[model samples]
Target: ADVDYWSGCLAPDKLAARITPATQALVAANANGHPAAWNELRTLASQHGLLLIEDSSEAIGSTYRGRVVGSFGDCAILDFTQPGPLSCSQGALVLTDDIDLASKLRLLRNRRLSDRGSVVAGGLPVADAGIGELNAALGLAQWTRLDDILARRKAVEAHYLKVIQSFEGIKPPYVAPDVDEVHWFLSLVHLGTRFSRGSRDDIVDDLHTAGVEAAAYCLPLHRQARYFDNQRPSQDLWVTDKLADRALALPFHAHLDAEEVEFIVQTAKDASINVGAGSAIYL
Candidate 1:
Protein backbone atom coordinates (compact mmCIF):
# COMPACT_ATOMS: atom_id res chain seq x y z
CA ALA A 1 0.00 0.00 0.00
CA ASP A 2 1.91 3.01 -1.24
CA VAL A 3 0.65 6.60 -1.02
CA ASP A 4 0.55 9.23 -3.71
CA TYR A 5 1.20 12.84 -2.76
CA TRP A 6 -1.18 15.53 -3.93
CA SER A 7 0.43 18.94 -3.52
CA GLY A 8 -2.08 20.97 -1.49
CA CYS A 9 -5.60 20.84 -0.11
CA LEU A 10 -7.60 17.96 -1.61
CA ALA A 11 -9.16 20.00 -4.35
CA PRO A 12 -11.22 17.48 -6.35
CA ASP A 13 -9.57 18.13 -9.71
CA LYS A 14 -5.97 17.92 -8.42
CA LEU A 15 -6.64 14.74 -6.43
CA ALA A 16 -8.58 13.10 -9.28
CA ALA A 17 -5.65 13.71 -11.58
CA ARG A 18 -3.41 11.61 -9.35
CA ILE A 19 -5.68 8.58 -8.91
CA THR A 20 -4.30 5.41 -10.49
CA PRO A 21 -5.75 1.92 -11.02
CA ALA A 22 -4.30 0.90 -7.67
CA THR A 23 -5.77 3.79 -5.74
CA GLN A 24 -8.17 2.29 -3.21
CA ALA A 25 -8.89 5.13 -0.83
CA LEU A 26 -9.04 8.89 -0.54
CA VAL A 27 -7.79 10.46 2.70
CA ALA A 28 -8.69 14.11 3.05
CA ALA A 29 -7.79 16.07 6.15
CA ASN A 30 -9.59 19.07 7.61
CA ALA A 31 -6.32 20.86 8.08
CA ASN A 32 -5.48 23.57 10.61
CA GLY A 33 -8.96 23.39 12.08
CA HIS A 34 -10.58 24.46 8.81
CA PRO A 35 -12.70 21.81 7.14
CA ALA A 36 -11.68 20.76 3.65
CA ALA A 37 -14.15 20.56 0.75
CA TRP A 38 -15.69 17.27 1.92
CA ASN A 39 -18.72 17.41 -0.40
CA GLU A 40 -16.48 17.49 -3.44
CA LEU A 41 -14.06 14.90 -2.03
CA ARG A 42 -16.88 12.44 -1.28
CA THR A 43 -18.26 12.76 -4.81
CA LEU A 44 -14.80 12.25 -6.28
CA ALA A 45 -14.15 9.17 -4.14
CA SER A 46 -17.51 7.56 -4.95
CA GLN A 47 -17.10 8.25 -8.64
CA HIS A 48 -13.84 6.30 -8.57
CA GLY A 49 -15.14 3.49 -6.28
CA LEU A 50 -12.58 4.41 -3.64
CA LEU A 51 -13.22 4.64 0.08
CA LEU A 52 -13.16 8.10 1.68
CA ILE A 53 -11.31 8.47 4.97
CA GLU A 54 -11.91 11.73 6.76
CA ASP A 55 -8.95 12.95 8.80
CA SER A 56 -10.51 15.28 11.34
CA SER A 57 -7.54 15.15 13.69
CA GLU A 58 -6.94 18.86 13.38
CA ALA A 59 -10.54 19.85 13.11
CA ILE A 60 -12.50 18.15 15.86
CA GLY A 61 -15.19 20.76 16.39
CA SER A 62 -15.10 22.35 12.95
CA THR A 63 -18.09 22.11 10.65
CA TYR A 64 -18.41 22.03 6.90
CA ARG A 65 -21.64 22.97 5.15
CA GLY A 66 -23.36 22.95 8.56
CA ARG A 67 -22.23 19.38 9.30
CA VAL A 68 -19.38 18.39 11.60
CA VAL A 69 -16.17 17.26 9.93
CA GLY A 70 -16.06 13.79 11.51
CA SER A 71 -19.39 12.91 9.90
CA PHE A 72 -17.94 12.80 6.37
CA GLY A 73 -16.38 9.89 4.44
CA ASP A 74 -16.90 6.10 4.64
CA CYS A 75 -14.85 6.14 7.84
CA ALA A 76 -13.56 9.02 9.91
CA ILE A 77 -10.86 9.62 12.53
CA LEU A 78 -10.39 11.97 15.44
CA ASP A 79 -7.06 12.23 17.25
CA PHE A 80 -6.88 12.93 20.96
CA THR A 81 -3.42 14.24 21.65
CA GLN A 82 -1.68 17.27 22.99
CA PRO A 83 -3.02 20.61 21.64
CA GLY A 84 -6.23 19.09 20.29
CA PRO A 85 -9.60 20.24 21.64
CA LEU A 86 -10.42 16.78 23.01
CA SER A 87 -6.82 15.99 23.88
CA CYS A 88 -6.32 12.97 26.14
CA SER A 89 -2.56 13.39 26.14
CA GLN A 90 -2.10 10.55 23.60
CA GLY A 91 -4.81 8.53 21.88
CA ALA A 92 -7.18 8.57 18.91
CA LEU A 93 -10.50 7.21 17.67
CA VAL A 94 -11.84 5.47 14.56
CA LEU A 95 -15.50 6.17 13.82
CA THR A 96 -17.48 4.29 11.19
CA ASP A 97 -21.08 3.80 10.23
CA ASP A 98 -20.66 0.26 8.92
CA ILE A 99 -21.16 -2.23 11.70
CA ASP A 100 -18.91 -4.76 9.97
CA LEU A 101 -16.13 -2.27 9.65
CA ALA A 102 -16.58 -1.23 13.28
CA SER A 103 -16.25 -4.84 14.34
CA LYS A 104 -13.16 -5.26 12.23
CA LEU A 105 -11.58 -2.18 13.75
CA ARG A 106 -12.31 -3.36 17.28
CA LEU A 107 -10.87 -6.79 16.58
CA LEU A 108 -7.72 -5.55 14.95
CA ARG A 109 -7.20 -2.89 17.63
CA ASN A 110 -6.65 -5.53 20.31
CA ARG A 111 -5.67 -8.61 18.33
CA ARG A 112 -2.03 -8.45 19.45
CA LEU A 113 -2.62 -7.63 23.12
CA SER A 114 -5.87 -9.42 23.96
CA ASP A 115 -4.19 -12.18 25.94
CA ARG A 116 -2.27 -9.79 28.15
CA GLY A 117 -4.09 -9.55 31.48
CA SER A 118 -2.56 -6.15 32.17
CA VAL A 119 -4.55 -4.65 29.34
CA VAL A 120 -7.59 -3.18 31.12
CA ALA A 121 -10.92 -1.75 29.89
CA GLY A 122 -12.52 -5.15 29.32
CA GLY A 123 -10.90 -8.55 28.90
CA LEU A 124 -10.10 -7.52 25.37
CA PRO A 125 -6.49 -7.30 24.36
CA VAL A 126 -5.24 -3.73 24.06
CA ALA A 127 -2.68 -2.80 21.48
CA ASP A 128 -0.74 0.40 20.98
CA ALA A 129 -3.71 1.56 18.95
CA GLY A 130 -6.18 1.12 21.81
CA ILE A 131 -6.76 3.75 24.44
CA GLY A 132 -6.69 2.61 28.06
CA GLU A 133 -9.50 3.25 30.54
CA LEU A 134 -7.80 6.29 32.06
CA ASN A 135 -7.28 8.09 28.76
CA ALA A 136 -10.69 7.04 27.62
CA ALA A 137 -12.22 8.53 30.72
CA LEU A 138 -10.37 11.78 30.23
CA GLY A 139 -11.35 11.98 26.56
CA LEU A 140 -14.96 11.29 27.52
CA ALA A 141 -14.90 14.00 30.14
CA GLN A 142 -13.72 16.48 27.54
CA TRP A 143 -16.04 15.12 24.92
CA THR A 144 -19.15 15.62 27.03
CA ARG A 145 -18.19 19.25 27.45
CA LEU A 146 -17.06 19.69 23.88
CA ASP A 147 -19.51 22.48 23.20
CA ASP A 148 -18.18 24.64 26.04
CA ILE A 149 -14.60 23.77 25.08
CA LEU A 150 -15.17 24.80 21.51
CA ALA A 151 -16.88 27.96 22.63
CA ARG A 152 -13.90 28.97 24.78
CA ARG A 153 -11.56 28.20 21.92
CA LYS A 154 -13.67 30.40 19.69
CA ALA A 155 -13.20 33.24 22.15
CA VAL A 156 -9.46 32.80 21.85
CA GLU A 157 -9.76 32.79 18.08
CA ALA A 158 -11.70 36.04 18.24
CA HIS A 159 -8.91 37.61 20.26
CA TYR A 160 -6.32 36.56 17.72
CA LEU A 161 -8.37 37.86 14.83
CA LYS A 162 -8.98 41.19 16.54
CA VAL A 163 -5.27 41.69 17.08
CA ILE A 164 -4.31 40.25 13.70
CA GLN A 165 -5.54 43.39 12.04
CA SER A 166 -2.57 45.36 13.40
CA PHE A 167 -0.05 42.83 12.16
CA GLU A 168 1.00 43.93 8.71
CA GLY A 169 0.98 41.66 5.69
CA ILE A 170 -1.27 39.06 7.30
CA LYS A 171 -4.82 39.16 6.04
CA PRO A 172 -7.96 38.05 7.81
CA PRO A 173 -8.22 34.27 7.72
CA TYR A 174 -10.09 32.85 4.74
CA VAL A 175 -13.12 30.58 4.99
CA ALA A 176 -14.69 29.03 1.92
CA PRO A 177 -18.37 29.69 1.36
CA ASP A 178 -19.25 26.09 2.11
CA VAL A 179 -17.61 26.00 5.52
CA ASP A 180 -19.86 26.87 8.47
CA GLU A 181 -17.49 26.96 11.42
CA VAL A 182 -13.72 26.73 12.05
CA HIS A 183 -11.81 25.95 15.22
CA TRP A 184 -8.18 26.25 14.27
CA PHE A 185 -5.61 23.80 15.59
CA LEU A 186 -3.01 26.55 15.76
CA SER A 187 -2.47 30.20 15.07
CA LEU A 188 -0.73 30.15 11.68
CA VAL A 189 0.32 33.18 9.64
CA HIS A 190 1.92 33.44 6.24
CA LEU A 191 4.68 35.87 5.45
CA GLY A 192 4.60 37.55 2.08
CA THR A 193 6.48 36.04 -0.88
CA ARG A 194 9.29 38.50 -0.29
CA PHE A 195 10.70 36.33 2.53
CA SER A 196 12.73 33.18 1.88
CA ARG A 197 12.57 29.96 3.89
CA GLY A 198 15.82 30.87 5.60
CA SER A 199 14.36 34.20 6.61
CA ARG A 200 11.34 32.44 8.01
CA ASP A 201 13.67 30.22 10.02
CA ASP A 202 15.44 33.30 11.29
CA ILE A 203 12.14 34.74 12.51
CA VAL A 204 11.44 31.49 14.37
CA ASP A 205 14.90 31.66 15.91
CA ASP A 206 14.28 35.22 16.97
CA LEU A 207 11.01 34.21 18.63
CA HIS A 208 12.81 31.44 20.48
CA THR A 209 15.44 33.93 21.69
CA ALA A 210 12.66 36.06 23.13
CA GLY A 211 11.20 33.05 24.94
CA VAL A 212 8.19 32.88 22.66
CA GLU A 213 7.43 29.45 21.20
CA ALA A 214 6.91 29.51 17.43
CA ALA A 215 7.45 27.21 14.46
CA ALA A 216 7.52 26.98 10.65
CA TYR A 217 4.46 25.37 9.06
CA CYS A 218 3.53 22.88 6.29
CA LEU A 219 6.86 21.57 5.05
CA PRO A 220 5.96 19.60 1.92
CA LEU A 221 6.64 15.89 2.50
CA HIS A 222 8.19 15.56 -0.97
CA ARG A 223 11.00 17.95 -0.03
CA GLN A 224 11.91 16.20 3.21
CA ALA A 225 14.46 13.34 3.44
CA ARG A 226 11.90 10.61 4.15
CA TYR A 227 10.16 11.27 0.81
CA PHE A 228 12.63 13.53 -0.91
CA ASP A 229 11.84 14.08 -4.57
CA ASN A 230 14.43 16.03 -6.51
CA GLN A 231 11.90 16.31 -9.31
CA ARG A 232 9.62 18.35 -7.05
CA PRO A 233 11.18 21.51 -8.38
CA SER A 234 9.68 20.79 -11.81
CA GLN A 235 6.23 19.76 -10.57
CA ASP A 236 3.09 21.87 -10.42
CA LEU A 237 3.50 22.49 -6.68
CA TRP A 238 4.65 26.09 -6.69
CA VAL A 239 1.91 27.07 -4.21
CA THR A 240 2.97 24.32 -1.85
CA ASP A 241 6.62 25.31 -2.01
CA LYS A 242 5.88 29.00 -1.69
CA LEU A 243 3.62 28.38 1.32
CA ALA A 244 6.16 26.13 3.06
CA ASP A 245 8.73 28.87 2.84
CA ARG A 246 6.68 31.69 4.35
CA ALA A 247 4.29 30.12 6.85
CA LEU A 248 4.69 30.44 10.63
CA ALA A 249 2.88 28.80 13.53
CA LEU A 250 2.51 30.81 16.70
CA PRO A 251 1.71 29.52 20.16
CA PHE A 252 -2.04 28.90 20.48
CA HIS A 253 -4.19 27.39 23.19
CA ALA A 254 -7.53 28.14 24.82
CA HIS A 255 -5.83 29.54 27.93
CA LEU A 256 -4.31 32.39 25.92
CA ASP A 257 -5.85 35.83 26.59
CA ALA A 258 -5.96 38.96 24.46
CA GLU A 259 -2.80 40.45 25.97
CA GLU A 260 -0.81 37.31 25.36
CA VAL A 261 -2.00 37.23 21.77
CA GLU A 262 -0.90 40.85 21.29
CA PHE A 263 2.52 40.08 22.69
CA ILE A 264 2.95 37.08 20.43
CA VAL A 265 1.97 39.02 17.34
CA GLN A 266 4.17 41.92 18.34
CA THR A 267 7.04 39.55 18.95
CA ALA A 268 6.55 38.10 15.46
CA LYS A 269 6.47 41.58 14.00
CA ASP A 270 9.77 42.36 15.67
CA ALA A 271 11.24 39.07 14.53
CA SER A 272 10.32 39.88 10.93
CA ILE A 273 12.11 43.21 11.20
CA ASN A 274 15.16 41.43 12.55
CA VAL A 275 15.10 39.22 9.45
CA GLY A 276 15.07 42.35 7.18
CA ALA A 277 11.43 41.90 6.19
CA GLY A 278 10.16 44.81 8.25
CA SER A 279 6.70 44.62 9.80
CA ALA A 280 5.44 46.97 7.10
CA ILE A 281 6.77 44.72 4.36
CA TYR A 282 5.88 41.05 4.79
CA LEU A 283 4.55 38.96 7.69
Candidate 2:
Protein backbone atom coordinates (compact mmCIF):
# COMPACT_ATOMS: atom_id res chain seq x y z
CA ALA A 1 0.00 0.00 0.00
CA ASP A 2 1.27 3.46 -0.82
CA VAL A 3 1.19 5.36 2.46
CA ASP A 4 0.41 9.07 2.31
CA TYR A 5 2.35 10.76 5.07
CA TRP A 6 1.16 13.95 6.71
CA SER A 7 3.62 16.39 8.22
CA GLY A 8 3.07 15.79 11.94
CA CYS A 9 -0.42 16.10 13.47
CA LEU A 10 -2.07 17.74 10.48
CA ALA A 11 -4.18 20.82 10.13
CA PRO A 12 -7.65 20.35 8.59
CA ASP A 13 -6.77 21.76 5.18
CA LYS A 14 -3.59 19.74 4.84
CA LEU A 15 -5.34 16.53 5.88
CA ALA A 16 -8.17 17.09 3.40
CA ALA A 17 -5.69 17.66 0.59
CA ARG A 18 -3.85 14.39 1.31
CA ILE A 19 -6.94 12.15 1.30
CA THR A 20 -6.93 10.56 -2.14
CA PRO A 21 -9.40 7.90 -3.42
CA ALA A 22 -7.02 5.15 -2.27
CA THR A 23 -6.65 6.49 1.27
CA GLN A 24 -8.34 3.81 3.38
CA ALA A 25 -7.27 4.88 6.83
CA LEU A 26 -5.87 7.88 8.65
CA VAL A 27 -3.20 7.14 11.23
CA ALA A 28 -1.90 9.80 13.60
CA ALA A 29 0.11 10.12 16.78
CA ASN A 30 -1.45 12.09 19.60
CA ALA A 31 1.58 14.36 19.74
CA ASN A 32 2.66 15.13 23.34
CA GLY A 33 -0.87 14.23 24.56
CA HIS A 34 -2.56 17.19 22.90
CA PRO A 35 -5.62 16.10 20.89
CA ALA A 36 -6.96 19.13 19.03
CA ALA A 37 -5.35 17.92 15.85
CA TRP A 38 -6.51 14.36 16.40
CA ASN A 39 -10.05 15.52 17.07
CA GLU A 40 -10.00 17.44 13.81
CA LEU A 41 -8.55 14.46 12.02
CA ARG A 42 -11.29 12.20 13.35
CA THR A 43 -13.93 14.51 11.95
CA LEU A 44 -12.25 14.56 8.56
CA ALA A 45 -11.90 10.76 8.50
CA SER A 46 -15.59 10.33 9.21
CA GLN A 47 -16.44 12.72 6.41
CA HIS A 48 -14.19 10.91 3.97
CA GLY A 49 -15.26 7.34 4.86
CA LEU A 50 -11.82 6.47 6.20
CA LEU A 51 -10.87 4.46 9.24
CA LEU A 52 -9.23 6.57 11.93
CA ILE A 53 -6.34 4.78 13.58
CA GLU A 54 -5.09 6.48 16.70
CA ASP A 55 -1.49 5.95 17.79
CA SER A 56 -1.84 6.77 21.46
CA SER A 57 1.56 5.29 22.25
CA GLU A 58 2.86 8.26 24.19
CA ALA A 59 -0.50 9.39 25.52
CA ILE A 60 -1.78 6.54 27.65
CA GLY A 61 -3.33 8.76 30.31
CA SER A 62 -4.35 11.68 28.20
CA THR A 63 -7.92 12.69 27.41
CA TYR A 64 -9.66 14.65 24.67
CA ARG A 65 -13.22 16.02 24.84
CA GLY A 66 -13.81 14.13 28.10
CA ARG A 67 -12.95 10.85 26.32
CA VAL A 68 -9.68 8.98 26.66
CA VAL A 69 -7.42 9.37 23.63
CA GLY A 70 -7.31 5.64 22.79
CA SER A 71 -11.11 5.56 22.67
CA PHE A 72 -11.41 8.20 19.94
CA GLY A 73 -10.63 6.11 16.89
CA ASP A 74 -12.17 3.06 15.16
CA CYS A 75 -9.07 1.28 16.42
CA ALA A 76 -6.15 2.51 18.48
CA ILE A 77 -2.67 1.31 19.40
CA LEU A 78 -0.47 1.70 22.46
CA ASP A 79 3.21 0.85 22.49
CA PHE A 80 4.50 -0.34 25.85
CA THR A 81 8.11 0.45 25.12
CA GLN A 82 10.52 1.46 27.91
CA PRO A 83 9.68 5.14 27.42
CA GLY A 84 5.90 4.64 27.34
CA PRO A 85 3.56 4.83 30.35
CA LEU A 86 2.87 1.10 30.71
CA SER A 87 6.39 -0.12 30.08
CA CYS A 88 6.90 -3.86 29.89
CA SER A 89 10.27 -3.52 28.09
CA GLN A 90 8.68 -3.80 24.63
CA GLY A 91 5.18 -4.72 23.47
CA ALA A 92 2.13 -3.10 21.94
CA LEU A 93 -1.63 -3.27 22.33
CA VAL A 94 -4.39 -2.85 19.78
CA LEU A 95 -7.81 -1.88 21.06
CA THR A 96 -11.16 -2.04 19.32
CA ASP A 97 -14.74 -2.67 20.39
CA ASP A 98 -15.60 -4.56 17.22
CA ILE A 99 -15.82 -8.28 18.06
CA ASP A 100 -14.74 -9.49 14.61
CA LEU A 101 -11.80 -7.17 14.60
CA ALA A 102 -10.80 -8.31 18.09
CA SER A 103 -10.96 -11.96 17.06
CA LYS A 104 -8.89 -11.34 13.96
CA LEU A 105 -6.30 -9.50 16.04
CA ARG A 106 -6.07 -12.43 18.48
CA LEU A 107 -5.53 -14.83 15.58
CA LEU A 108 -2.87 -12.58 14.09
CA ARG A 109 -0.97 -12.36 17.40
CA ASN A 110 -0.84 -16.16 17.72
CA ARG A 111 0.06 -16.50 14.04
CA ARG A 112 -3.10 -18.47 13.34
CA LEU A 113 -5.35 -18.33 10.33
CA SER A 114 -9.04 -17.54 10.74
CA ASP A 115 -11.19 -20.45 11.97
CA ARG A 116 -12.86 -20.57 8.56
CA GLY A 117 -9.49 -20.96 6.85
CA SER A 118 -7.32 -24.11 6.87
CA VAL A 119 -6.17 -24.71 10.45
CA VAL A 120 -3.33 -26.67 12.02
CA ALA A 121 -4.31 -28.92 14.91
CA GLY A 122 -1.16 -28.80 17.08
CA GLY A 123 0.30 -25.33 16.46
CA LEU A 124 0.44 -22.43 14.00
CA PRO A 125 2.39 -22.93 10.78
CA VAL A 126 4.27 -19.62 11.30
CA ALA A 127 6.06 -18.07 14.27
CA ASP A 128 3.75 -16.56 16.88
CA ALA A 129 4.02 -12.86 17.70
CA GLY A 130 2.12 -13.28 20.96
CA ILE A 131 3.36 -11.54 24.12
CA GLY A 132 5.39 -13.83 26.36
CA GLU A 133 4.18 -14.73 29.88
CA LEU A 134 6.83 -12.58 31.57
CA ASN A 135 6.05 -9.45 29.55
CA ALA A 136 2.30 -9.87 30.19
CA ALA A 137 2.94 -10.17 33.92
CA LEU A 138 5.04 -7.02 33.89
CA GLY A 139 2.37 -5.18 31.92
CA LEU A 140 -0.29 -6.28 34.41
CA ALA A 141 1.82 -5.07 37.33
CA GLN A 142 2.37 -1.72 35.65
CA TRP A 143 -1.37 -1.45 34.90
CA THR A 144 -2.14 -1.95 38.59
CA ARG A 145 0.20 0.89 39.51
CA LEU A 146 -0.92 3.17 36.69
CA ASP A 147 -2.61 5.76 38.90
CA ASP A 148 0.44 6.18 41.10
CA ILE A 149 2.69 6.42 38.05
CA LEU A 150 0.44 9.03 36.44
CA ALA A 151 0.36 11.13 39.60
CA ARG A 152 4.13 11.15 39.93
CA ARG A 153 4.58 12.03 36.25
CA LYS A 154 2.06 14.89 36.59
CA ALA A 155 3.97 16.22 39.62
CA VAL A 156 7.18 16.23 37.64
CA GLU A 157 5.40 17.96 34.74
CA ALA A 158 4.22 20.66 37.13
CA HIS A 159 7.76 21.26 38.33
CA TYR A 160 9.08 21.57 34.79
CA LEU A 161 6.24 23.92 33.81
CA LYS A 162 6.89 26.14 36.82
CA VAL A 163 10.63 26.38 36.16
CA ILE A 164 10.29 26.72 32.38
CA GLN A 165 7.79 29.59 32.71
CA SER A 166 10.53 32.06 33.65
CA PHE A 167 12.84 31.13 30.78
CA GLU A 168 12.40 33.70 27.98
CA GLY A 169 13.40 31.69 24.91
CA ILE A 170 11.85 28.36 25.88
CA LYS A 171 8.24 27.35 25.34
CA PRO A 172 6.64 24.35 26.95
CA PRO A 173 4.43 21.95 24.98
CA TYR A 174 0.89 23.27 24.52
CA VAL A 175 -2.08 21.43 25.95
CA ALA A 176 -5.45 22.08 24.34
CA PRO A 177 -8.41 23.18 26.49
CA ASP A 178 -10.27 19.97 25.63
CA VAL A 179 -7.41 17.84 26.90
CA ASP A 180 -8.24 16.93 30.47
CA GLU A 181 -4.94 15.20 31.22
CA VAL A 182 -1.46 14.63 29.84
CA HIS A 183 0.91 11.76 30.45
CA TRP A 184 4.27 13.22 29.52
CA PHE A 185 6.71 10.62 28.21
CA LEU A 186 9.36 13.32 27.99
CA SER A 187 9.28 17.01 28.72
CA LEU A 188 9.58 18.90 25.42
CA VAL A 189 10.54 22.53 25.00
CA HIS A 190 10.61 24.67 21.88
CA LEU A 191 13.65 26.87 21.53
CA GLY A 192 12.76 30.40 20.45
CA THR A 193 12.80 31.37 16.75
CA ARG A 194 16.11 33.18 17.20
CA PHE A 195 17.75 29.79 17.79
CA SER A 196 18.58 27.48 14.88
CA ARG A 197 18.88 23.69 14.86
CA GLY A 198 22.64 24.15 15.51
CA SER A 199 21.84 26.27 18.57
CA ARG A 200 19.42 23.58 19.77
CA ASP A 201 22.24 21.02 19.46
CA ASP A 202 24.47 23.36 21.45
CA ILE A 203 21.87 23.45 24.22
CA VAL A 204 21.79 19.64 24.20
CA ASP A 205 25.60 19.60 24.46
CA ASP A 206 25.47 22.03 27.40
CA LEU A 207 22.86 19.89 29.14
CA HIS A 208 25.16 16.88 28.75
CA THR A 209 27.98 18.97 30.20
CA ALA A 210 25.76 19.57 33.23
CA GLY A 211 25.15 15.80 33.42
CA VAL A 212 21.55 16.12 32.33
CA GLU A 213 20.60 14.20 29.20
CA ALA A 214 18.73 16.11 26.48
CA ALA A 215 18.04 15.54 22.81
CA ALA A 216 16.20 16.84 19.78
CA TYR A 217 12.67 15.46 20.09
CA CYS A 218 12.30 14.34 16.47
CA LEU A 219 13.57 14.89 12.93
CA PRO A 220 11.36 14.88 9.84
CA LEU A 221 11.28 11.27 8.63
CA HIS A 222 11.07 12.28 4.96
CA ARG A 223 14.23 14.35 5.35
CA GLN A 224 16.22 11.41 6.75
CA ALA A 225 18.61 9.73 4.29
CA ARG A 226 17.12 6.26 4.80
CA TYR A 227 13.55 7.38 4.10
CA PHE A 228 14.21 10.09 1.51
CA ASP A 229 12.90 9.24 -1.96
CA ASN A 230 14.22 11.36 -4.83
CA GLN A 231 11.57 9.87 -7.14
CA ARG A 232 8.69 11.30 -5.10
CA PRO A 233 7.76 14.93 -5.67
CA SER A 234 9.57 17.33 -3.31
CA GLN A 235 6.89 18.44 -0.86
CA ASP A 236 6.98 21.45 1.41
CA LEU A 237 6.88 20.63 5.12
CA TRP A 238 7.66 24.04 6.53
CA VAL A 239 5.79 23.61 9.81
CA THR A 240 7.22 20.17 10.50
CA ASP A 241 10.73 21.26 9.52
CA LYS A 242 10.56 24.31 11.79
CA LEU A 243 9.26 22.25 14.70
CA ALA A 244 11.92 19.59 14.14
CA ASP A 245 14.57 22.26 14.34
CA ARG A 246 13.32 24.00 17.50
CA ALA A 247 11.90 21.20 19.65
CA LEU A 248 14.13 19.72 22.36
CA ALA A 249 13.38 16.81 24.66
CA LEU A 250 14.49 17.16 28.27
CA PRO A 251 15.05 14.54 30.95
CA PHE A 252 11.69 13.36 32.27
CA HIS A 253 10.52 10.46 34.41
CA ALA A 254 8.30 9.81 37.44
CA HIS A 255 11.38 9.60 39.68
CA LEU A 256 12.66 13.12 38.89
CA ASP A 257 12.72 15.34 41.96
CA ALA A 258 12.14 19.10 42.22
CA GLU A 259 15.84 19.83 42.62
CA GLU A 260 16.75 17.86 39.50
CA VAL A 261 14.10 19.67 37.47
CA GLU A 262 15.42 23.00 38.73
CA PHE A 263 18.94 22.12 37.69
CA ILE A 264 17.80 21.04 34.23
CA VAL A 265 15.77 24.20 33.69
CA GLN A 266 18.62 26.44 34.88
CA THR A 267 21.11 24.63 32.68
CA ALA A 268 18.83 24.94 29.66
CA LYS A 269 18.32 28.67 30.26
CA ASP A 270 22.05 29.25 30.59
CA ALA A 271 22.80 27.17 27.52
CA SER A 272 20.30 29.02 25.32
CA ILE A 273 21.72 32.36 26.44
CA ASN A 274 25.31 31.23 25.96
CA VAL A 275 24.60 29.82 22.51
CA GLY A 276 22.81 33.02 21.50
CA ALA A 277 25.75 35.05 22.71
CA GLY A 278 28.19 32.94 20.63
CA SER A 279 30.52 32.38 23.60
CA ALA A 280 29.87 28.65 24.19
CA ILE A 281 31.31 27.35 20.89
CA TYR A 282 34.45 25.28 21.50
CA LEU A 283 35.20 24.47 17.83
Maximum-lDDT candidate: 1
Q: For candidate 2, which ten residues in a row score worst on lDDT?
A: 1-10
Per-residue CA lDDT of candidate 2, range 72-154, in tens? 77899888886667889867899999898787777677753454476556433443667889999999999999989989989
Off-target runs (Cα >4 Å) in candidate 1 are: 1-8, 112-128, 229-234, 278-283
Q: Positional deviation of 210 in candidate 1, in angstroms? A: 1.2
TM-score computed on alpha carbons, candidate 2: 0.86
State model 2's lDDT: 0.76
Model 2 Cα shift for residue 244 (angstroms): 0.7
**Model 1 quality (TM-score):** 0.87
Task: Provide the overall lDDT of each model, using Cα atoms, as 2-decimal numbers.
Answer: 0.79, 0.76
- TM-scores of the candidates are 0.87, 0.86
- Model 1 RMSD in Å is 4.6
